[model samples]
Target: MNFFTIKTSWSNAEFILIKLCMASAYILIGSCFHDFFENHYSVLIGVFIITAIWFVYQWLKKMKSHSDIPY
Candidate 1:
């Protein structure tokens, strides 16, 4: 109801949206690389590293969300 409360709720919503975007991005990127790496194991390893980095970033962002913020 107050300004800070409203701001926090909005920020939480944004965080959720960002998490979704990250997940979709990883899925799409990984699948594309997987398909393209059929004959190249080295490329597949690179893709895995990139995807792992993305996952870590997303996890950190999600952890930043305030649990007290009202959805």
Candidate 2:
């Protein structure tokens, strides 16, 4: 691993898992407002869980690889 080049000690499976996590984070963040638009408490809560799960799954993927969820 270097500034110009990248290398990961994690297995391919781990990398995929991390990417999935990051993606989910984004989805949750998007869904967060769905409740407001439709007025569904379940949607709001569901989004919250997704957001939280994605927040933690962030560690699954390499931070430097990509910002799966926008800052």
Candidate 3:
């Protein structure tokens, strides 16, 4: 499976499951690094903000790719 390519064949349930798993994984990672951030709230917030931006960028790219392909 291609990590950068969003599969069009996933069912609604499968898509939702994947989303939930990703979210949980992100949260788990943040928790693991909580001490590494020195418990600084601002730094933690910045990390989450960057993550959100990355997700949005990827989503937009995926949408564009899908649009360019003829179904």
Superposed Cα RMSD, model 2: 9.2
Q: Which sections of candidate 3 miss by over 4 Å?
A: 1-38
Which residue pairs overlap in candidate 2's backbone?
A: none
Worst 10 residues of 2 by lDDT: 1-10
Best by lDDT: 3
TM-score of model number 1? 0.38
Instruction: Itemize residue pairs with steric clashes in candidate 1.
Output: none
Better of 1 and 2 by TM-score: 1
Query: How well does each candidate superpose onto the true structure, as a TM-score?
Result: 0.38, 0.35, 0.45
* lDDT (Cα, tens digit) per residue for candidate 3, span 1-71: 35566554435654553465466556657767676544565554565566666666666666677776764
Per-residue alpha-carbon lDDT of model 2 for 1-71, expressed as tens digits?
24455433566765564465565556556756665444554554565566556545654455546534443
Reference-based lDDT, residue 40, model 3 = 60
Tens digits of per-residue lDDT, candidate 1, 1-71, equal 34355333335644554565566556656766676534555554555566666656765565467555556
C-alpha lDDT (0 to 100) for residue 27 of candidate 2: 57
What is the lDDT of every predicted structure here?
0.56, 0.55, 0.59
Lowest summed lDDT window (length 10), candidate 1: 1-10
Off by over 4 Å in 2: 1-8, 35-71
